[model samples]
Target chain A: MALVDDNLTAAGVAMEGEVSDYLALLKPRVMSLVVFTAAAGLLVAPGPIHPFVAAIAILCIAVGAGASGALNMWYDADIDAIMSRTRNRPIPSGRLDRQTALMFGLVLSVFSVALLGLAANWFAAGLLAFTIFFYAVIYTMWLKRATPQNIVIGGAAGAFPPMVGWAAVTGNISLDSVVLFLIIFLWTPPHFWALALYKQSDYAAAGIPMMPNVAGERSTRNQILVYAILLSLASLLPLATGLTGWVYAVPAIGLGLVFSGLAFKLWRAPAEQMKRNARELFTFSLLYLFALFLALVADVGIARFLEMIS
Target chain B: MTAPTEPEMLSKEDSDKLAKSRRGRSIALALVLGALAIVFYALTIVKMGPGVFNRPL
Candidate 1:
């Protein structure tokens, strides 16, 4: 029976081809956000890292994120192959094989963790390792398929980059780090849910019960509005805690307002108009988070410059 | 850049894709080794004290 199950599994697996297939396993776009957020953590932290070391830390973050993406791809390939939106991904598109993605993820995971440990303190290195585990094992293998609450709980994995970034620089977590963490954590649901709204059938057809597909679109949009309000309120924490200046403040407020407005628009949308609003909100939320973090980096940079000139 | 002369000669172009695939692993190896060398030089040879990780702002 066991051998038969193994044979069945092997037979069920899809074969993929091409070099870009392997590259696609890395989810480069999501890795970019991870790299940027982690870089901001390092840049804004209260200490100095040698330029080269800082770059290495960022590289380690990129690699770890890439590894997580690969692991996610490896596990999700089954469902991903079913979803129209995701069917072109490496494993699903028959460009890269599943076992190859598995090996690639494992190799990159070990290399990233070991190199981060050697390049920086064990504190930062350990956090990176844990992040890989959380995303790959906890979220991907466990929560995502098991629960509609998956993203809400598993969002912590995505939110950890800035904290890892802070640790890379300071080797400790702070209120500011927590604030940054909270911002991303709160932001995740609204960001992902909007996509879920637009991609409901893809998710439903894939047998992944995304909230919009399971609970209904109205409920999903309402949740998006709630998370957006909570996210907007959460954005104010960084400024309130003194981690950001007006550079981050003005734009955060502006961005948060627009984000909330979009959520409101999404909430009030007619059924015909709902998916369009969700798509726009989904796209803009990514930009909103990137801009918020960039603004933080700039504010801190300018503050440091002023301090030096004075 | 320039107003696009896009796809003026699609069929005649060099198959750089072939060379890129053939050379990709070597290029990646070189980058990795070079990075390792820089890390080694920075940490061991130059003897710069561990750079300040973070100082309270």
Candidate 2:
């Protein structure tokens, strides 16, 4: 009887992971942003791609981003359990076990990369694979715990999707794609530092060494302002490179000013009001990136339409 | 050391829930596989064009 009971348990007769639990592991909110940005990259590229191929590239990028999220969740489950913001994630919440999450992430990562190679060019596929590795191994395992500059460098993983999308269409990186990469890369520091400001206690408890907890809030706020200024300037590179016209340029400049303005307010905010200001900046940063990318796509579409009519 | 004890068995309700979860996962997996097949078939058709069917054996 004991032997039979052990066999059933070994066969996962007690497994309780639901579909939603698996989905939550993917960090769908982040995946949505990745999908939007990747699609923007694909749409704004110089040459045309079959609609079907473009769809596949976007799907692969989304899945690859989700896979990395799962792997991050698996590795960070311990810290996640300690941090209030992450305490309810699948692994930390006990909705799914670590091994199950790890296996799921690995399987999805492999399938997404392989399918992307088969569907798109291998260069794009290679970029997807590197993005996954950088997120799972470098950011999650090493830099996240090792440095206060975690998100500063770890931001590269999140920034790669748009470049991968561009490569999927062009089969090579270009100055335009690099500009897109720079925009997000610069945006990450201010964006995450804002969140870190409000969630300082959580990182402290988790021993994660986020910028706000490691550097004083004053210093962190200073850094955020600097990055915001740099991001504002980088957002205009599309115009300099002729990738976008005043349509994108106007909105990019407007959004960047607002982003910088918020960061400036957050910097000068009194200690008593710091958290509120940080929260405000964090919320607007999301809209800023989304709007900036949307403006780029619209600008490119308008340009192409006018050329076609002429 | 004492002999190892028998593993605890799940209650009927818990067993039913587990079974349902497993079924849901299976269905999700099946749908994903089906979608993959459609993507591959469409890609092959798009890449090769109508001439794909006329290729010499």
Task: State which candidate has the highest DockQ.
Answer: 2
Evaluate every candidate with DockQ and list the scores.
0.04, 0.56
RMSD of 2: 1.9
What are the per-candidate TM-scores when only chain A is compared? Answer: 0.93, 0.97
Instruction: Estimate, for each residue in B1-57, the C-alpha lDDT of model 2 and write its tens digit.
Output: 999875666777767777788899999999999998999999999888877899678
Residue A220 displacement in candidate 2 (angstroms): 0.5
Going through the candidates in order, what is the number of backbone clashes in each? 7, 0
Instruction: Give the Cα error of residue A160 in candidate 2, in Å.
Output: 0.7
Top of the candidates by lDDT:
2
lDDT of 2 by residue, A17-51 (tens): 89999999999999999999999999999897899
Q: Per-residue lDDT tens digits of candidate 1, residues A99-204? A: 9899989999998888777777789999999999999999999989888888887899999999988998898889999999999999999999999988888888
Query: Residue A8 lDDT in model 1?
Result: 27
